[model samples]
Target: MKTKILFLLSIIVLGTTSTLKAQKLKKFGSSIEKKIGPKTIKVPYTDVVSYLGYAAPGNEDEVKDGKKFYYIYVWVPAVAPELGVRMMSPVGKAKTKNPIKSEAYTKNAKSKDYFDTYITLERSDIISADNISQDAVDSANWVILERNDDSGEMPKQPSGSSYNSLLRYKSDINDPLKALTVGLYRIGFTTYKTGEVKGTFLAEVAAPVKLPGVVMAKTIADLKAGMSK
Candidate 1:
């Protein structure tokens, strides 16, 4: 009788575990649909044009190896032909008296610093409805801008900018989203000329609303095992 009772208890525990897992999986799926699903935006450069944007949900306040970070999605337009956008960050204050010796100082610094910057696109060959492929979209470049020391806002005039450059997401271990960190970032067109016509948009990195895809996948697997038992 005791052996039979033990067996029954084990079965009950297994069943409970499975039910909980499945519930978590469903919740994750719903969250993804709401946050990272397909989105359409009008490419700002053209008077009237549209492009699809796809992004993955990010995690909030993720702690690893004694470091804190917040992951957020950075998106790129699918139909941008000749124009490319990148992320920028402010040049840190110079610590050395000689500007040339300062690591933060650069040769390509902009003229006047604007507290609030604008991003615009220009010199485009043409605008069309040609949809960019998933592979191309996945491989597109993204920017990571550092947050201001005093505020969450990104610096208006970046001392330096990244255009058509590779980001951490490209080399993330297993997932690109893992490369995102807590900070303020800018999304704007890449231009050769410093004062060329352009527009800028600010992206604030914060806590995520849902679990990442990897976590959700593990939860679903656990749910399956529990249900099978």
Candidate 2:
């Protein structure tokens, strides 16, 4: 009788642990649906824009900063003329100049005329148009921007004007997505003067993974053990 009781208790404990693990994993991802453009901007232009939904690792109310950004990764399988990408703020203006063609846009960027802010990769330098080869998609120029500033003011440009256009925001306002002010922002792509070629491109957003402190600690410990030679 005691053996049967012990077996049942073991089963109950194992089932509970499995259920907890599943719940923890689910908390790390939240589904989102957002897309913009494919509308013709000019009278004869057929500019198309499409966006892919990305899952952030937490609830919508979570605050995201420079350390924790909602990254957008773009892949263009074919090349086209006059292609440019920018992030549009909720107020219907380009928040930053095109990171792909920094030279042509630097004059405006320096004056803080068109866009007062910009985004850059946490890992690598922005991929410029000159760097992309015709044969393959340039993964190096993938879209990653810092979150917008909270001060409602344009960040001050540096002295001597050796503009690091990629670094636009003050350090304090680096967290662009705060739960209270979070809203849909557009990641735009323009393919100009290409008549009916039907070139392909993709855009996807990446949100950080949120895990409980205990779960995160265990994950770290496991990674450490695995890495130890």
Candidate 3:
């Protein structure tokens, strides 16, 4: 036991790091590299010509029983064919009520996984120390994301931004090393957006995120244990 503890500590020590801008841990077996914030905005969401989910023009009327949903949509950038209506959506989740074949659109379907398909900004401040206790993330509008030429929200979902479970701390020392504990996050998704699983989806469902040792540990474990229900 002592050996294991020491090993983890050693890894943390040699693996710890802080940058002038943001503190980040070395990609040791237990940490994620972060570029701390007060970050600049490169792509204002306005660049998104058209969005599909509830986040589009008519968000109010998109809900049912206090919920809204959005799906894959087309985005026409200012740059013409350089980028056309590229389809996008979250990946993950086996249809709760169906036996349909796997769909590539099965990409990250988590309430949080939004796609801007066009150029967007970095959605930093994802989870932080203070508001970490507030399980209101899923309903928290949208997160600015940055990939290549595109970045944007997960497109509002019909969910309350609620989910099957909520993220929580498993220990006195919140395991920043892993994802938000082991339970399913109560991400409120609008019924409309989370459509039935079909053979063909715009994008694939979301895959589990493997952010090195720390984040992947619990997620992988939960998956192995038949979580994500």
- Scored by TM-score, the top model is 2
Residue-by-residue lDDT tens digits, candidate 3, 1-229 = 9999999998776543211111111111111123448653322111112112212224322344444433321111111111112223332221222222222223323344432222222111333322322233333343322122221222222221211111111122232323233222211222233433222112211112321111111122332233123
lDDT of 3 at 228: 21
- TM-score per prediction, in order, is 0.17, 0.21, 0.19
Model 3 shows how many backbone clashes? 51
- Residues 56-120, model 1: lDDT tens digits: 11321233333333222222223112222222222222121211111111232321222222232
Minimum summed lDDT over a 10-residue window in model 1 is located at 24-33
Cα shift from native, residue 43, model 2 (Å): 11
